[model samples]
Target: MLRNAASLSVTVTALVLSAACSDDGREASASASQPTGVSTAPATDATGGTTDAAPTSSGTATSEPTTATSATATASTDDPVAPKFDIGGKDLGASTTGEGDGCKKVDFLFVIDNSASMEDNQAALIASFPGFIDAIKTTLSEVTDYHIMVVDSDADGRCEQPCVMDNDYQEFCSPKNFHACNANLTECDTTRGAGVIHPVGLYSSNKKCQVFGGNRYMLPEDPDLLATFACVAQVGTAGHPSERPMNGMQAAVSEALNAPDGCNAGFLRDDAILVITILTDDPHYEDEGTPAEWKASVVAAKNGDETAVVIAGLIPKPDLGCAGNGMTQGAHWQEFVDSWGDHGISGSICEPDYAPFFQQAVAVIDETCDNFNPPG
Candidate 1:
């Protein structure tokens, strides 16, 4: 099921500080409540398999700024050519706008949990992704530049083991032994926080997925976006049992990983609107820091413009009876999503189809792009 926080009773008052950047002159607020009258229904998947459908919910909340200060732009006396905005104490010149006031570039980050219980979730994400991107391309027609990257929850990339032994007794790790293993022993796997182009664990294809450039992430010019994305997004189910999505997200956009020589170099852009989508059934109890601190890390990465980031996720919502089997409620994840107000979207991981949630997220992403004032 899909629920937007705006439908709830929470009121968020945003103070738009700049007139030049506030074309819509609107503020966004949202909060979530447990849905009532819940009932279980069998939902069929693309493969004809049946799964439980989430409870019916209202439409998604409209995207808007929360209590946080919106981005502002001021005329620069030093340079007469363009205006400058102070982002995280650094003055960045404004980029030339398109036909209307909207961001020309967008960066999409997908954080996927690769634990033992994520096989179905990963397949669902891979199956639903083409339509999601197609919707974005159609709805946000002006956005021609894009950077899409995927990262797994574990930073170590080691596989869980009791290694599988061959006829000669040589041991190795594979998807067959993913559930049978108890300790992390296989070291040759995809690195966490780095954009995945070559996944090597559990159910991974274990082949290098090529993009337009030799970069780790996918660009708009990639020859086969669907195929490449599917290859890397299938991170498999051999990651550390204790998932750390927040840490992976923070590290993915951190300066260390975005550096010229880093594994995820050139994935993040200062002038682009950032949209992060996390897919996981784990509660992430092992992840460090509070929701506020995690939000701060992302905002800081985006030059401190909270409005430039959009957080969306398919997580366990136990309160609504939408959590997967053996999955606890993701309290921290829920709080993190709520902290973004309208910019945040949370969906139940138990849903039979993730397409609807992703489709709803497009509206929020479009609004964010419309209001984004890119740094020059």
Candidate 2:
């Protein structure tokens, strides 16, 4: 009797497994009609399965209600509210056009360290400049007055110097004299001679443009923009080993604003916006007082109006990834950036691509301005 009972139990278990494995679909369909204590979501009928069929009193499948799958909507980054402008940290605010005279004046001062290590980075900046101009013209729109200038960070203001290869006194001298001098001399006035290339903002007045045989205005629409930018930006790969970009910038601006009928005359205006971009790989001292004092001078240069000036830094970031074998973040420069608050933006100089940084500068300028519209 016990053996018979055991054999019967085995047979029952086999029959249950066979029913569960069967593909008839009636069991699944019937289960759908019943509900357990736990709440569950409705199921949709799949292909090869019965469509919303219910279990009848006889346990046969019957027609039941069905639910259609609902489509979900996703937000796209192309939306108007999507963030568009970014520096290293936060997204810049969107720009709006306001009521004003049609003319919008923009002055750009680029203070670049022309040290031996800057050749490759300078090339990268020039390569990425077209995009920067386009971002200002196309994105910012109708800038009536736009002027650009370049200044070297060689701040020693030396006269004739020794060969840059021999001594490190390449300070404030032009790179064009590196071949003539046997040893780089510290006291030579670099602010003179071939090394002190004229600012591009004063292209018409700059004799170097004539020397280079370039046309009158090297504007964005000019055909010889590459040659023009190359000439102005080719400040040489032999500048002071301890470059002071802020000092160089101060000297450049001072020459432009102070000189009687200066070379950079008419470039800066009370109504126009002023922009300064400093590019370097290594940190240097702030010679003219603290960063705050220098910032005050920049603001004062723009008629004591902070709104008219914007300063951008494209130097080594405050990070291990940005500094290199012989370079580090410009600590005083970072302080200057902090002084400007929203009026300033920064990017990493170590980056091989400069388009993003250039674009960010334009965007920050746009945000700083009350309105983006140019004159009618």
Candidate 3:
């Protein structure tokens, strides 16, 4: 029910899900389409319901480059508009002195891979994760600070397919609804039938805030969000449990490049930038080790330099990824992802398009721009 997408360039969008009820008649919400003002955040009291953030390194940015990924905005239909900058560069003394200057701040981590043949990518992220927060609040209407997590890298605590584990995760087990019968009260109690998918939106960016979905309890992007979707069902969504393949965007870019040292955009905010997109058609298999130990687990989940911008869609390309049509080989795991594009890892092969692949990944977050601002 989700593959619908209006897509791109600074503005003009739409997302609709609205269906109510949920007590006996059975029906929750998915509702979308709303872009006016924008400022959301708040709704996390996690504690082994397991929010597990905690990674804080630091650096910075503003903006003003020209040819790296070629930045331009202003396309409006619902939201793309962004342009008119002081996005600074040459490290302009680490920029930002005025109203968040061209507002960089970003931290998005989605390391999804639900196994069990990924049950249609976990039902396309439970019906398009509410059009991915309605395409990021229709292009950042002040995302109140932005922080979204959606892990399932072979889950950790409960849920194998209607869970009830005791792996020492302590209390709050899963599976057995009829009102969790007694789950300390009632945050969720659907008998644990909806695993292979948790790690939803995790609100806190601006104006409206809330996240947690797979069946529904709270899913707001903006509509006066006061805080709700805190369902927190952390587990392996389905069953790929052979273990040893958890790269959940290298643990959400090491918590957005080690955030904390002054923390601005929730993580550490030296202009803040950390975006990992990892969708999956399954192919990073890595035989558990040895491609130099799986490229050293992707360079230790990219702890190298600039920090975060992982992008790995792998949807349904392979006709040589038709832009001009390109596909000599590579589609499964190893060979010709454009011949490994010299291993630097640029992207292209998109065709399945679930909302223009989240509006071209929110217009490729210019880590100070140099190439993909809109290039790929």
Candidate 4:
């Protein structure tokens, strides 16, 4: 449950009395007693109105009033207006210590959109990656074991046109030109072609790689973590123009479950927290299945313990408005996040900097870990 610090306001009243006196030190009585006055202005500083000098009256004081004004005033310290740890105007729900035997492990799957328009977003994410890791480490003392993997948002099942080896990461084709003639060249697929970089192939297909000593886990302590992430994350613009990130994620997880000695076989642990973060600017294709189905796929992969999963997203937010350039309100992405309750957090993908997003995500993860109910 969420805890709040309450500020208490107490009102204290002090009685003051004054009278006019003669030169002989005898009281010069007034016709009648003046009414008592009270200052109700709130103190604005920590000194509690003590620092400023008090005003003096010309009349000499004889004795204080015997009749004291007795009144008690109490102001609620609880902020009825705002919460301290709010994100994008939404108050985070009552936190729960996630189900686990301590926060020993975490499995992070980043489904990055590697389309034509995601270059800047990708750069921001990469630059902020270290901060995210630092936050996890800072909170947990040390994360016992964590696996990080990347998959691009392209699961269209159709090969992109004229696929070839243009980039250095292209293991799909060789250096030699497959299509060439006296002018009018016809581009053709090599033996591996489209499937080589496909999400399914990287995780579930027979062509799945044994990059980590015949397994798919990439440790946080990996010597070349950034380069490795960048390699897989840069899926390039050669993929089909229409993206299916939900389908891609589903395929990746499904492959991890079914493939023989699959890349993701040992990554998902029984006690580990699973964080699946999607970075996309477009909406999920309707043909890729609804958000419910995708969520179910994740739950199933995590052994039906919904407490073991956190699905965060960095996509376009509504009010900030992704107005320019053929962008929707990211309603479909928001729909996916809404289904997860406190298990999900969504931030704007249009921000030029992703540091705040990373920090908040890390903080959320830390809070989730703190709420986890460890086994006996």
Candidate 5:
């Protein structure tokens, strides 16, 4: 159960009395008569005017006729209010201790949309990743083993047409040929749901990416994690315009892809907590299957243990002013994220800086890691 801080309100009432001087300049007696009993009826003042008795803190009426000089009411709320820690908010919660005896290995899968108009969003994600991983390392100190993989939303390989690879293994497309190609071009259909080691599509880096142990994913032992991630995560903008992020994510962790000779082999571990982060400006309408089914596939990858999975996304949230550039609201993605309850978090993809969003995600991930029970 999610815990929320309670709000407190205080009310203070002060009474003041004035003492008048006599004609002889001697100070008059400043003592005021006290009420003998609690008043249930209206009390009449010296001027014959009836005034309603004031209620004390205990909700009982007092017969005192004293004047109320001032009344102050103050209301204070805790730092993280109920809405702050809500399902899809930017401020989820504070950092957790992560001291529970749970799964210590974490697997992170990034499903990034490589469609047009995603250059800035991809750049923001890459720029914010270093700090995000650092915070994770500090907060989840026990988690020393990690597997990070990046995959594009295009499973059909729409950019393969009108584009060809040069002798140097560089992708050369019409009007953009002779330019630097940083992607690793492969059989179009083979990239379906495969971990992107060298992104080979339009708007890509056009450079080959080398991972430690020649694996498709990144491990903790990989030297210069930031540099390697920057290379592989630059899945350029020349993908299928109809983004299918859900399909990509589902296939990335599917049993076929994680087999011994599969593309994403050894990426998913039974004793590790799974964290899937989706970055896209498009909705999930282009993807196959419903949000419930997508979630089931992910949970199934973790041996049908839903508690061991966490989902976060930076998508178009119209309510949060995150809709623009032909980016409609992400109702399907929102439902998917909401399905995870506290283990899910969604942020506005239009946010100029993604640092805060990733920072807030750490709190949700930390809580999920605390209670994660690996399947024996």
Candidate 6:
């Protein structure tokens, strides 16, 4: 059973702290074509905060219980001013990472919360992932480079950490239409148009990929990220959260910026404008517990290269408690809107279908970034 969840408020408090951290990796762009974001605010005291950590389980790997200490950005950083948005105002006081315009390439990493409650959600997510890539594919018809990192809270720390890579050290798509999968991976069924993936998802069990035969599992069919599955079930434990999200966010944006070998990954160009799309059911709190966490995630994502963040909150839009409990699970997304730095999109999953929720968000983001190709 869910460990005696922290008392409702206590649980919310714990979840909140994990979202806020003092790690700032900020940078500024030399041109208006680049984007920048920062992660430095103040260290948070995760003490007494609730643990959304998934419980330990006998899985493919040893679960590495993360500790949420008062951490700092301790990395080469950037500091850019925020960007424009449709809804919220920009937090003039908030920090950012980089600056620039558009990007030609994009290395997207989708980090999902796969706790028990997310089981069905995860399936839906997996089913829908290829769609996002497909739409992106339409815009990048000439480019075929991409990568994915799917994180599930429950991972065997020793064998496969929660944030382990599916295609680490390798690129995806093809050189010719390479945006689907690298030339090496052909098992993928790209017939429906999702396109094959290169460098494919890697499983911790096969580090060198000798056993599974890199080509055997690296294909791109219907958004298969099973490589990161075993550990996706180890969340909701009793300790603390993690700090890698901030780091991962940076990596994704970096890929979007410089792309491969100083060249854009294939979309537009390494220096092409960057746009970020975030979908979460929870809040990015700003309290001592969560503000830092959310900021860190944002910083990693922006890295200032002319990035635009579009947040889609799974929770329906409410008139009140935006700064408190209701939003704690879905933190600073509102801050982004308020700052006019990021557009905040919301919907009620209470309805039978979440498509409208997703569509509305996609629409808002499309309008803001001026880049969107709805599934035809």
Model number with the top TM-score? 5
Query: Which should have the higher lDDT, number 2 or number 3?
Result: 2
TM-score on alpha carbons, each prediction: 0.68, 0.60, 0.26, 0.59, 0.69, 0.38
RMSD, one per candidate, in order: 16.9, 27.8, 20.3, 24.7, 22.9, 19.2
lDDT of 2 by residue, 1-376 (tens): 0001111100000001111101111222111111101100122211111122121111111111221111112233555332222222222333444333423668778887765456545666676665466556654565645767677776432223332432333332323343324333222124521123442111111225322323212344555665677667765554545567777667556644345555444445666777888877654453556677677777767767776777877664333233332322355665576566556665555544455445546555775554423322
In model 1, the worst 10-residue window by lDDT is 16-25
Q: Which candidate do you rate higher for TM-score, 1 or 5? A: 5
Predicted candidate 4 versus true structure: per-residue lDDT over 318-361, tens digit per residue: 33332112233346665666566556666655544444445445
Q: List the residue pairs that clash in candidate 5.
A: 181-206, 182-205, 182-206, 182-207, 183-206, 183-207
lDDT of 5 by residue, 296-319 (tens): 999899888887888877765544
Clashes of each: 1, 18, 56, 5, 6, 114
Off by over 4 Å in 3: 1-107, 111-149, 155-157, 162-221, 224-245, 248-274, 277-287, 290-370, 373-376
Best by lDDT: 5
**Model 6 C-alpha lDDT per residue in residues 185-262, reported as the tens digit of each score:** 222221111111222122111111221213211223314344333222112111012212222233334444334432
Off by over 4 Å in 5: 1-100, 161-184, 187-189, 324-328
**Pairs that clash in candidate 1:** 93-376
Q: Distance from true position, residue 143, model 3, in Å?
A: 10
The alpha-carbon lDDT assigned to residue 150 of candidate 5 equals 93
Model 1, CA-based lDDT: 0.61
lDDT minimum window of 10 residues, candidate 4: 45-54
Poorest stretch of ten by lDDT in candidate 3: 55-64
